[model samples]
Target: MESKRVLITGAAGFLGSHLCDLFIKKGYEVVGMDNLITGDLSNIAHLFKLKNFEFYNHDVSKFVHISGKLDYILHFASPASPIDYLKIPIQTLKVGSLGIHNLLGLAKSKNARILIASTSEVYGDPSVNPQPESYWGNVNPVGPRGVYDEAKRFQEAITMAYHTFHGLETRIVRIFNTYGPRMRLNDGRVLPAFIGQALRGEDLTIFGDGSQTRSFCYVEDLIEGIYKLLLSDYAFPVNIGNPDEITIGQFAEEIIELTGTDQKVVYKDLPQDDPKQRRPDILKAKELLNWEPKITRAEGLKLTYEYFKSLTKEQLEKIDHKDFSEFTR
Candidate 1:
């Protein structure tokens, strides 16, 4: 039997790289693509040696072209972190808009199933405790985080349109706070920022009073959920994340214990539009895909901490001090 072929955008990113690994493990011929803007080539360096893996150094926002038949396409090409989107706001918008449009058309032409990588930020500062897919969301289009949030919102809309109007096979996964190996230390996310600070023997910085809550799903668990969703017949957006919620302050303390380093928590002003509470109501995912995170925060954090510790002192120092007033809380 011939192997399935999958084209994954953002192939060098944290999540995209993992998805590539998963598909390759499942006997799929993987064609990885990335612009290398926020993506690091080091993440997918090991895959280059495999016979079934091929990579393209191209941006999807311009035009996407895939030779031969394609069985699947996973669109994960975007600046996900606040540090990234705030720095390159225009590119973020373009990828969510033009990039997705190009890929949907490509999927249509190849008659392939395409899955989009959406974010929990779509439920901006959500009023509900555990956000479900039915929530319309409260987003400020002109806010600082608007560029990325609105871009994802547009991605979801166009994807569904392609499903209904063009009859394209599309799957949307609204990813929550996911953490694991290969994560950038200075990406301005709470997990990496806290871990990087603890590694550097610096104080952990909390943007708010520490009342804000977030649920984190491990990378392996998230990748499994994504794969299951792709193969399932359902097409609507589904949330994939751990439901075990913890406040930013409480999480900081947990980091201190995990790192075995004594660090004080420092408070700062919270960024505008930063979600105060972020826990996914994964009932749909559970009932539909039979998916829920199996790895505990303790287990995942230990593995991640070890990965960070293995880095050289130079790598630790690379976590430079930048203005994190707009962190992805």
Candidate 2:
């Protein structure tokens, strides 16, 4: 039998790069595309030497053209972090809208299965606890964070349209907070922020009294769920994340202990539109994909700490001073 050919946008990203590694290990011919807008080449630099791996430094927001028939297309190219999207809001919106449309067109041409990487942020400041896929989000249309959230919401809408109108095979995975090795230390997400602060011997900054809660899924577990969803027969968006909730304050303390740092807690005003709580109910994932997160928070954090420790002193310094205020604008 012939090997499957998989095309992944944002293939150099934390999750995308890991997906490439997994596909290559499974003997699939993998093509990774990234504009390197926020994705670092260093993440997939090692994979360049792999015989089954190929890469394209192209922006998915623009046109994407490829030869031959593709068996799969994973459209994951977009600015995921608030800091990134805030700085490049136009690009964020374009990738989710135009980029997804282009990829869907390509998938239709090749009769290939396509999976879009959606986000739990689609449920903006959601009212429901342990949010299921059935709940319509409580999103603010004109909020500062709306650029990214609404773009994803529109992405899902168009994806479903393609599936229903064009008869395209499509899958959408609503990713929650995911962290692990290869994550950009300066991404400005909560995990990296806390970890970077502790590593730099600075005060751990907690916003809004540190009472806001989030459920984190280790990268490995997230990747496993993504792979399962891609192969499953389901088409609607499914939540894939760990359901164990922890307060931001408690999470910061966990980082301090894990990093063996003596950093003290410092409170700051929470950013506008910051969600007070987030936890995905993965009953659909469990029932359809038979998936659950395997790596506990402690185990995932330790592994991530080791990866952060392996960075050179200069890289660590850069991450230490990374400005997060830009993400809010």
Candidate 3:
């Protein structure tokens, strides 16, 4: 009997690699693909020896080629971090537009159920607290962060188009701030950035006076929700995240306690269009998917800090970053 096959884009990334492990555990033959533009190979390198897992070093914004049957497709290829997206804004837009189109075409060709990884950035700086899936969003299409924000907005728009126009099988999960192992320490995300500074014996830099709030979901909790959403019949975007929200200043303090760091938070000017508050309203997710995050913040933070602690001195000292100036044109 042939096993079911799943295709995962951005398989080398923190989230996508974790999805690969979950699907493989569920008896699927996993086909992993990444451009490595923002994903790290080390995240998925452990699966190289598995007979059922295969990988391709191909960028999805270009032509995507895959052989054989594919039952599912998870499109997660994009410069997700602010640093990466801001550095290569063009690529970020391309992946959300061109990359998604390519994967949707492939899904149609293979008759596979497709899931697109959307983000809370689609909400931009929301007027509502705990944003619901129905909100139209308040976004600055011309802001510095617009490249990534508008790209994701377009991704969701087009994805819904495919669902309504072509009647394609699809799922969308608008993930919130997720933290766990395999996350790059220098990605400029709040968790890793704070932890990196502490580990480097520097003050924890908090942009925007550290009052802006964000809700975080553990990677495993997010993966579980996504997996269930993929198998379910829901077609619209679903919000999957921990509802336990905290202010950046408060979170920095938590990290200090967790890592046993003596450093304190330092404020800086917030970047343009940075969301002042973001926490997903998961009621729809609750009623529809029968899912909610089970991991407590304390437990999750302890686990994440341990993972950061496990890195070598060099890896901890500096994280991988790319020079995309040559390709941005």
RMSD of each: 3.2, 2.4, 1.2
Q: How do all the candidates rank in terms of lDDT, highest first?
A: 1, 3, 2
Cα displacement (angstroms), candidate 3, residue 236, comes to 0.4
Worst 10 residues of 1 by lDDT: 320-329
The TM-score, computed over Cα atoms with residue i paired to residue i, of candidate 2 is 0.96
How would you encode candidate 1's per-residue C-alpha lDDT over 1-329 as one tens digit per residue?
A: 99999999999999999999999999999999998887778789999999999999998998988899999999999989998899878889999999999999999999999999999999999999899999989899999999999999999999999999989899999999999998888787999999988987899999989999999999999999999999999899999999999999999999999998988999999999899999999999999999999999999999999988898787555434333334223
Q: State the TM-score for model 3.
A: 0.97
Candidate 2 Cα lDDT to native? 0.90
Alpha-carbon runs more than 4 Å astray in model 3:
317-320
lDDT of 3 by residue, 137-165 (tens): 99999998899999999998899998999
Query: Which prediction has more favorable TM-score, 1 or 3?
Result: 3
Query: What is candidate 2's lDDT per residue for 1-329, written digit by digit as tens?
Result: 89999999999888999999889988999999998777778889999998888899998877789998799999889888887888778888899999998999999999999999999999999898988999898888788889999999999999999999999999999999999987776576999888877777889888899999999999999999999999999999999999999999999889988988788999989988888889999999999999999999999999999999889998766544434343332
Runs of candidate 2 exceeding 4 Å displacement: 317-329
Better of 1 and 2 by lDDT: 1
